[model samples]
Target: MLQKNVLDYLDSSAARFPHKLAFADEARSFTFGQLRACARGLGTALADLGPQHNRPVAVLVNHTAANLAAFFGVLEAGHFYVPLDLQMPLPRLRGILETLSPAALVYPAGEETLAQALADLCPVLCAEEGFAHPPQDALLDARRGRVLDIDPVYAIFTSGSTGTPKGIVIAHRSVIDFTEWMADACQFTHQDVMGNQAPFYFDLSVKDIYLTLKCGATTHIIPKKDFLFPTLLMDFLEEKKVTALVWATSAFHLVANSGVLEKKVPSHLRTVILGGEALQAKQLNRWRAALPAVQYTNLYGPTEVTVDCTWYPIQREFADGERIPIGRACANKEVFLLDEHLQPVPPGQPGELCVRGIGLAKGYFGQWDKTRSAFIQDPRNPNYPDLIYRTGDLAVMDEAGLFTFLTRQDGQIKHMGYRIELGEIETVLNSIPSMEEVACLFDPERDRIHCIYTGSQESKDIAKLARASLPRYMVPNLYHKVAVMPHNPNGKIDRPKLKEEWIHGNDHRL
Candidate 1:
């Protein structure tokens, strides 16, 4: 059957696995039947609350089963969901709300105070109350009938270069295509239980959420606090009998670096997929050593590409210093590299990674200018309108058509009349046995390269290693050692924060 709406996934799964747990959190869970009931009921209420159709419905709540229900509920009501992280500051949240101008704002019960603050912007709907509303089948069916594959399903906000967040709007077709390809590529089954680590607001979570619905599998929303203690996280996965893990590379690195996997591993974990940053072989080797039989996949793409356009299933052993290719493009998607002139780069040369096909997002919501800047017409085609998203990420394609991500376009800087990639320096430093984490930044004002890292090695030793490996200009001009590396909410290194603190704020130590 052709799936026009994402709700179709939930409806089919609900019928097939009525009594099975669909989503679960630490405090509560929802069976497929019950989740469908909650969604229908909430959909009816949302339909009655406003007359808006195909608009954004902002959902501000913690990561829980109820939150997932709210997401489906928004879709059931014929509008796209915009998940807002509860931890987001009011200023940023306000900015997003101002830009979204959603038809309604859904919040968990007992958060009336927070909800009320934004009530002026939109109608506030209590998720708990909405779940209790009686389902209007005819009304919901009518709404569902109106939905189309090209309509937006959700909009996830990502940081823009200009400081404001850009809401990346994804259509149902894009997600449907991506999710279908992911399920087939990853070989997901109903028996697989997923341990979801990415926050719902982040696009990475899309795979865990939709894949479970598509496969009729169960998903356990691992608590954010569990990630801090690797042992506790492993225990949760073990207790839940989680067979799959869709996580960020940082989360994987945390567990491997913590040495918890050496002592104890998630015995039932069979598949591990990582993204949102480069996957270092040092940490990956640790996981492979611990779970030799487990399938490991490295995914690459920005949020604008509907989660991921390329994936590399680990096939052979890699040394700690080797780089893993992101592999070929996924089904129903096309990924290619283009140089600054918008021409295909020669094989093995770095170029901006561009993506097209069914998996590409609709574009940024309410920011047409910004959207036009990133999502442009395919230069190769002038006769017809064919769109491709410019990812701004630099990567190199090998002779075999496998892509190896290098760094962000901004991460490549001109130093001493030579263009160098910061990621290359970090990759080299990361290969060091004693180096735990490393980030390279450039100081344009002083014309120096700054290397901030958390490792046991002294600054002098790291400098010596860099001198031996990198060219004189490519070697870091400054090295700062810290006990711990800072990360953002999505688990990627907070380079901007590190730059503010280590590079711009204090340089005396360097």
Candidate 2:
């Protein structure tokens, strides 16, 4: 049965196992008792902020234990949090604030400089200690109440091709729906030690935080420094006896293909979840060859739907297919494949993916028109009907009626007035034996689509490879090979970083 609220999940889990270990990053660990106290304290401190209190609170932090603490703490406080990593540039960070006018901001204890910059607009809170301490025994008394059934919980910004950013507003109800669906399927326990490889700003951290607090389980969080070292990551996973993991496709690929992960798999690990981007079969094959005992899963969802809306449990009979199909809708959420006319498209035809139920967000912040336009009232069902979020990604249903993702419907360009699929061309390029990874983006201002590639391909041969697979306009006007493609906190290819480098020649705006 669905509870009256999502925070009650922690209440129930805490009662069941209060003294059990709850969180573990690299340097610290906390029990359920400690974790709850910190969350409630922080929640109490912000409770007095009135009904207008539902505005966005910006956070400049990383994936530390403090970040997770603040994530739940602020959500429980009844305000939506917008996390911005400290690693992003000042100009980009300023642009995000200008677009999404948050109510308050939080920063790491020592980042006084950043906090000072934000203090003029909203109150700035500094968290120096981990989630387990500091906030405890505070003089600030919270006006305790209940988390509203319809309050927005958080907002994540997606890079907009329109020279702006879109902040997706998710609510507490959606978080509960996703947590319930995930807990039932994953079967986590206090015995499991999970790792947090993603940044707190990313949606992947939602699972890492909730599952730990739910079971009083311990989480092994990796620091920013270790992301560059593949061997160190393998050692961390094995040393901590990590039973489950939530990360991007690239993180696991770094370990599976690295010679250190050969033959020795963690025996206790039961589930390995991958999301935030596409997963290739070759990456899965490499991990399966080593960690045969670990059951794998590929999760899919936009920030609009909490963390995940659908999942495909990786099976042993895995066959090599062109693309991995994003599985059925989550337990409490409703999934619909709709045509251009907003009607349900039949199986095996391309259409837009529409989502409803608790998994759907309240809507985009500050953009009521876009919100109402995208979150449509479904004409199909009336009883318990909710607005459906229109996912702009184009998808086709499989024979089993599951969704097979093709590409983003809006992420294309027009050259010579002809429409082009930037992703399709990149997919073809990545298929070549010499290519390792590729990114394709259109520069509308430049009137040209550009590509930045990584691998062993010679600069002279890029045009040849494109000639074999891509049409004339689809082929990039310029190509460059670098050591590796950069990624933002969300694990997607960092196009801002790419554009910055292309413009300034040595900018490290990561």
The residue ranges of model 1 lying beyond 4 angstroms of the native Cα positions read: 506-510
lDDT of 1 by residue, 414-508 (tens): 99999999998888889888888889999898898989988789999999998998899899998988888998877889888888886688668
- Residue pairs that clash (backbone atoms under 3 angstroms), model 1: none
Error of 2 at 329 (Å): 1.6
Measured over all alpha carbons after superposition, the RMSD of each candidate to the real structure, in angstroms, is 1.1, 4.5
Candidate 1 to native Cα RMSD, angstroms: 1.1
| lDDT (Cα atoms) of all candidates against the true structure | 0.91, 0.71
Q: Local error of candidate 1 at 398, Å?
A: 0.7
lDDT of 2 at 281: 67
Candidate 2 structure quality by residue, lDDT tens digits, 1-510: 655455666677678877777777766666676666767666555443444456677888766776766665666566668888887887888888877767567677679898787677677666543233334233222211344657777788766555466788877767766776687798887787887888777778889877776666788787666667766676677788888988887677556545455745666677899987776665677678777888798888888778777788877554322467778887878777888788888887778888877778777777788778878888676776557888887777877867767678866567768977676676666665566667776767657666788778886798887886677767778787888789765667877677767744543321
The total of clashing pairs for model 1 equals: 0
lDDT of 1 at 284: 96
RMSD of 2: 4.5
